[model samples]
Target chain A: MKANKVLINTLAIAITFMTLVPFVWMVSASFMHQGEANQFPPRLFPETFSLEHYLRLFISMNIVRYFLNSVLLSASITGLSLLVNSMAGFAFAKFHFPGKESLFKLLLAAMIIPAQVTMLPLFLMMNQLGLINSYFGVIIPGMASIFGIFLIRQYISSLPDSLIEAARLDGATDFQIYWRIVLPLAKPILVTLGLFTFMGTWNDFMWPLIIMTRESMYTLPVAMANLSGEHSQDTELMMAGAVITVLPVIIVFLALQRFYIEGIMLGSVKE
Target chain B: MKGKRLFKVWMSPALFLAPALLLIAVFFFIPVVVSFLMSFTDFDIYSLADSSNARFVGLENYKNLLSDPLFWKAMHNTLYFVFIGVPLSLFVSLGTALLLNSKLIRFMSLFRLAYFLPVVTTLVAVAVVWRYIYHPSFGLVNYLLSLIGVSGVDWLGNPNWAMPALILMAVWKNFGYNMIIFIAGLQNIPPELYESAQIDGAGRWQELLHITIPMLMPTTIFVSIITIIGYFQLFAEPYVMTQGGPMNATLSIVLLMYQEGFRWWRMGYSAALAFVLFLILFAATLIQLHLQKRFSTV
Candidate 1:
């Protein structure tokens, strides 16, 4: 039994290391100076690490612009999506509309209709609105997702109605009740949903790749794909770009992982 | 009294739902309808320059799609991806979940975090990293293969290996998510069942086969459905890694749509492609649900 336990522990360690090697290699390769990572035998560590690639990215590649665009776009989308989705989610959960159940059911069923189905018409719509090649193009369609609303509604529905009733008796307005009573009560789900929106907007590639035609408006992943096209042979530099694109998400997930993981579990359990 | 209360409820729900519903209708629903309409007409580069140039092509684009060998290639590639990728990911997720859920496992949190880190990372960046890892001459993958006397195969450049490579990366990136779900499913299984099996002189393998597998079926089915749906929509990886290239071996349905719609501005044809994909996904989802119902009834 003791031998079996040791073997199992060893296997777990091996698997963990295997899982981490790709990310570790990405980080390590990013630190290597140009030409350092391309050596035979695949150097696990750079002989003399330098920040030159990162410097080059910000100075030569105008990556700072792309980085800022990503940050600003992700922030705006997250904030606006949270506000819109939470209101909708709260209504679905707590309010008793004539078609509340049916509407909610429709949204749930519509979830399976992949977002790709809308891309063509959405692009035309954006073009018509003059939002194409603008940040608003990427931000508009994503401002309120059915999934976000569903997630929030599922969490908020469990909140006690007594709280809202007491607030109403105090002559608090519906908006006030939502702001003071419901929003605060649903903080955990809000954070989780917010993280989902932020990460999703940040990581999104294809939509931005389509809509954001101008180089200046490009988000990180879109910019990175463009950069890769131009600099595919620049392995070390490409690694630096990948690191920049992936690092913020990795950091955010590490920081708020409890909520993120909980969100996934929540989604799964409800199904 | 009931009328007044009903009115109040209606007003509140309307107020709450207005923003999200409006966004969905304007952005999602309207576009989907317009795209469907556009697919019936010949909306292409000529139409872009002058809307008057567009004409009703009827089934011309759909007919072209059927004859277009590229479209068939994409269909085959996407089907291959879904058929192979889904089960492989499910198996890996289940295996990892069982391992992590084992009582003897130590440092479970650390292991869980390690496995899950890939899922949350940006796909474009991960694709970029994997692109490097697949480099024929000097990549880590090739280097590792060399140690075992295996010649370095051009992973992305080769038509035969490109889809499989993408599938491998996808599975690596996604399995952790379902693994987390599977872990939850595993934990919910009653320990008494395992104990009773053990009391019957069953070994660990028998207990797992008899108890754990049966109990986890519902979770597995749900996971498989979602995974299949997600895999069918493959785009960014091929767009970034292969550009659906080396003979169009990696062109997925969404990638095909993107090319026709955005790259070539064949909006009408692209919309039809999108609808076809939707039909396929809807059919698959219904089939899974029906199977689940049948199994539960039995």
Candidate 2:
């Protein structure tokens, strides 16, 4: 029994180390000076760490611009989506409009259709709207997603109806009730949904690759891809770029981890 | 009061649904419909200049797609990815979930974060990172393999290994998501059942086999279906890394659709490919639903 316990403990430790090693190695390699990473016997610790590549990325490559773009785009998408989807979610949860169930059912069915199917014509539509290569192009398609609405509605539905009724009885307008009452109560899921939207927008690659034509409009992911294409040989610099692109998301996830993990379970449990 | 009540009722839903419905219709639904229309017509470079140039070909693009060996190759490659990648990912996720949920495990959050790190990382960045990591000589993977006395294998350069390499990276990136879901399911399992099994003199293996697996069926189904849907939409990894090459071994349906739509300006043909993919996906979704229903009833 003692031997079995020892074996299980060792197995657990080994698995944890294996899971963490890639990320640890990535961070370690990012900090190492050029060519120091590819050393024989694989130095897990940097003999000489430097911020030269990071400085070069900011100075030479305009990586900060891409970072700003990711931030701006992700924030805009989140803020707008929260407003839009929260309203819709509130309605779906509380309001008894005709065809509410059918409208929602249709949206749920539409979820099965992959976003890629719409890419071709969405590109054309954006081009026609003079939105191509603009932030609006990327932001517009993602402004309101069915999943976002569904998530918000699920959370909103669980809230007691008597609260909203009380607001209505006290002469709060429908919008006022949503903003003042439901919104405050639904804050947790809103944060969860916002983080989800923000992370998704930040990490998105395909649509941005399609919509944003010029180098100037590129998000961090797109810029990283472009950088890899151009500077495939500069492994250290590329690692630095990867580090920059991935770091914000990791930080965000770590900071709001409780909400994020709960959000995942919530989303998965229903559908 | 009635007027105010009616206005409140109509306005709330309208205000709420309008934005999402509008965006979904304009950006998602309309474009999908437009793509369906586009698949039937000869929409190409000339059509971009003048819409009049696009003629209704009436399934010519579909016919051409059927005959195209490149499309077949892409289809074969995609199926290979779906079939192999789906089961492998499921197994890995289930394995990790089992390990993580084990009573002997400590520092669960630390391990969970480590496993899930790849899921949240930017795909382009990871692909770029993995491109180097799959580097035959300098790669971490090869370096580790060499410790076991195995020679370095050209992971990306070799056509045979290229898709498998992509599958490996993809699995590594994605398995954590399903693992989390499975962990939730595992945790949800009633502890009393396990205790009951223990009192019945059931061994660890028997308890897991009889108790855990049966309980996890619904979650397993959900994970597999979503994983399959996601695997079919493989685009960014190959786009960033291989551009669907060493002889199109890694070329996927979406990548092929992308080339035909954007790169070559064969929009109509690409639209056709998109519909066919949609059809295949629809079928897969139905199968998943069917399986779930069957399992539930049984």
Number of the top candidate by lDDT? Answer: 1
Clash totals, every prediction: 1, 0
> Going through the candidates in order, what is chain B's TM-score?
0.95, 0.96
Name the TM-score of candidate 1: 0.97
Candidate 1 DockQ vs. native:
0.83
Q: How big is the positional error of residue B138 in model 2, measured in Å on the Cα after superposition?
A: 0.9
Tens digits of per-residue lDDT for model 2, A14-110: 8667666666777777888888776656777678888888999999888988999999999999999999899889889999977889989999999
Give the alpha carbon lDDT tens digit for every residue of A1-271 in model 1.
8998998889888888877888888889989988888878999988888899999998988899999999999999999999999999989888876777888888888988888989887877787789988988988888989999989989988999898899989999989988989999899999998998899899988899998889988999999898888899998898999999999999999999999999998887544
lDDT of 1 at B80: 100
Model 1 spans with C-alpha error above 4 angstroms: B1-7
Question: Which window of 10 residues has the lowest lDDT sum in candidate 1 chain B?
Answer: B45-54
State which candidate has the highest TM-score.
Answer: 1
Q: Write the per-residue lDDT of candidate 2 for residues B114-162, one digit (tens) a residue.
A: 8887888788888988887887877888899999998888898889999
